[model samples]
Target: MPILGLKAPGPSTPAHFSLEPLIRPNILALQPYRCARDDYSAGVLLDANENAIGPALPSASAKKVKVNGHSDSNGTSGASASAEDIALETLSLLPPGTDLNRYPSPTHDELKRRIAHLRGVPDENWVFLGVGSDEVIDMLFRVLCVPGKDRVLTTPPTYGMYKVTANVNDVGVLEVPLIAEGGKFQLDEDAMDEAFTANPDLKIVFICSPGNPTGTVIPLPAIRRVLENPKFKGVVLVDEAYIDFAPSNSSAAQLINEYANVCVTQTLSKSFGLAAIRLGYLLAPPPLIQILTNTKAPYNISVPTASIAASAVSDAGMAVMAEAVSTLNANRDYLLETLPTIPSIGDILGGNDANFVLVQVLDGPKGKVCNNRAVQVYKTMAETRGVVVRYRGGEIGCEGCLRITVGTRTECEEVIKQLKDLLA
Candidate 1:
């Protein structure tokens, strides 16, 4: 059965020796609801038995009166920059209850339109809103993978959700380890090719640019090579969750129109400072987007989440945040330069484009080991220094490494000072 150019295994089709079974027996047997496209049309008054009158709750800040004051130069102003104040100031011009009561356009059309404008993609090719990019990851698995039959290929020491989501869906995971020579991590294209060749049933390939934990962006040629392979014609999910931090152009968003099999997932959690709001999006072919939207539950996005995300994507705020990205990059560079000077630290993995730096601990003079010892040190740093950094030893290829998120100059200095004392 072919849907969206790719072939799904037909009822009588025999499983090829190279190709594992396409769908899990349960998923294959299950029937999905097929609602008419017109069911979601704009002019609907009564369709799916929704309350035509809408919710009874008033606007969030409607009761509170606005207090006038000068806008603070710094982003954080105590009582003066409260949620009410921020909402009143930023959205003051818009009419009351414009976005407050009505269930946010279920598919996030306006938000997607703005994102398309920003990313330079045709709105038709994008799937705009998700709870987070993590939802996109899970949705791809749910829509494409045949749980227990279809598998996903991922490079180790990459994003954890690729495996976690696979496991949740009971899908097989084929691990292709990254090259870890000299403590610098690089994608092993040959290993990836071998994995795809060995498991022709692999439905998804998750590539994280400026990867989490390591922060090394996969080289462009490596990605191109994977896409070029005939055996790897399945969806290539290039998770650009941290791409804004990197200097390299995003492969998924940039090349979406050119490749039908590619999907790029991004989150406002990192750069947009809206992690708490949980707005993530996927840019993919419209056919794939249709499948995802069909599978997803109604009212996936809350009223508050939509409002905050829309506000964050405002032009003025995005420009200000671009400078914040530069600041974080500067802090990352500072840590990269200053960290190796500490006697206890060994090689640093990634400080390339992302905000975090991964540092390996060196052995002591007595030949003491320090890889898996990161958790203890992580706890010490948190307890004594009042600082927190991710310890990544338990992750696939991250033995003996701590992932530290770069903050303001003062914050970075405080962390460095604490590390220096610990090393001493």
Candidate 2:
């Protein structure tokens, strides 16, 4: 079958894969609901029937909330600085003429352009904005999978949300566990191929790079092998939520320009430090992007979220993110080195390519990993102690493990301090 031949589709140009067939017919033929700000944003006086009186927030502080994303004296994004101030008084201002009384731009072209530049994609045409990667994931299932008929493939010990979303959509999820016994949390290409061959009807495969709970990146060559497979014709969704912490070459986004079957979802919630705004996007071929756009809600993103996200992905914003990633990577290294010094610590899993680390808590001060003690440590740290780290001991290949986020120097010290006292 030349459908998804095992060779590169063609080195000259992107594969001419027809996305219409991949998308649900209803979505492909969808007549998107035109939003208020779709046509004219300049002279929109009275079109969408918005409240003429403007927002209820004190206009004095509200208008002053304009989050100028331009660079600060420190050469970092001003918006990044402002966002870090969690105090309620730091109300963000809207973009010029971005009236709170009116709806936000449906396309968010400026935001898409920033994302395109950041991802090194051709242009905004290659981007699809979503409430978060969760929205993108849910929509992928909605537009690609048929309820109770079609299914998606996922690697175990990855993100849990993929399965939860699958269940919510009533779609079957085929689990192919990563090479856990190897202690690397890497993709098992052979098992994955077998699963794809067996489940020929699968429509989507979720590859969580810099995998959640694992903190390791799946190699791009492995991803290419999956994409080029003649048997699996489904779309490959690469979740790169933590790609900022990894080397640039590790991103699956580099494959989007070449592979029609590949899509990458990213977010400002992580390295960009905009989790409160809850923004994420997908980078894919224009056809797939159009399909997602058509199927998405007309006004999915709000005024404030778009403003903040646009700034976060801006040139200045990216610089800030780079510096932040560097700091976190250093902290991750510190954790990897220090966690072992604690008594009863076993091997630390994953590549340490993310802002977090997964460490195995031992039975006593040094032998084999003990899941029970790890659970106890997790609870005590959260309740008894003033710190909170995720308990991933129950996850596959992560038995007796705790997932710790690399926090500020003081916060990390507190975690290490608590672990030492508790385990001692």
lDDT of 1 by residue, 1-424 (tens): 3233222221211112111133333433343433333356467645555566654433234422322233342344346587655554444433345544344456667778888777767773466478899988887888788767778898888888898999999988888877877655677888888887788767888888878877888777777667667777577788888888887464457666666666788899998877866889888756566556656776788766766676677798688679889888889889989988877777787546677888876554233437645677788999987999888877765677888888899999988898878767
lDDT of candidate 2 over 1-424, digit per residue (tens): 1122121221222343445577776666776457765566666478878898877654334344344543232323445554334322234434555667777778888889878988888888889889888999999999998888889999989999999999999999999988988468888899988997788777998999999989889999899888888678788999999998987799999998888888999988899988877798999877677677778888899888898787777778888988888888888878888888989888898877889999999989668899999998898888989899999988999999999999987888889889989988
Candidate 2 collision pairs: 65-92, 65-93, 66-93, 344-365, 344-366
What is the overall TM-score of model 2 with all chains considered together? 0.90
Task: Give the top-scoring candidate (lDDT).
Answer: 2
C-alpha local distance difference test of each model: 0.70, 0.81
Q: Which candidate number maximizes TM-score?
A: 2
The Cα RMSD in angstroms, rounded to one decimal, for candidate 1 relative to the true structure is: 5.6
True lDDT of residue 217, candidate 1:
80
True-structure lDDT of candidate 2: 0.81
| Residue pairs with clashing backbones, model 1 | 210-217, 371-400
On the 0 to 100 scale, the lDDT of residue 334 in model 2 is 81
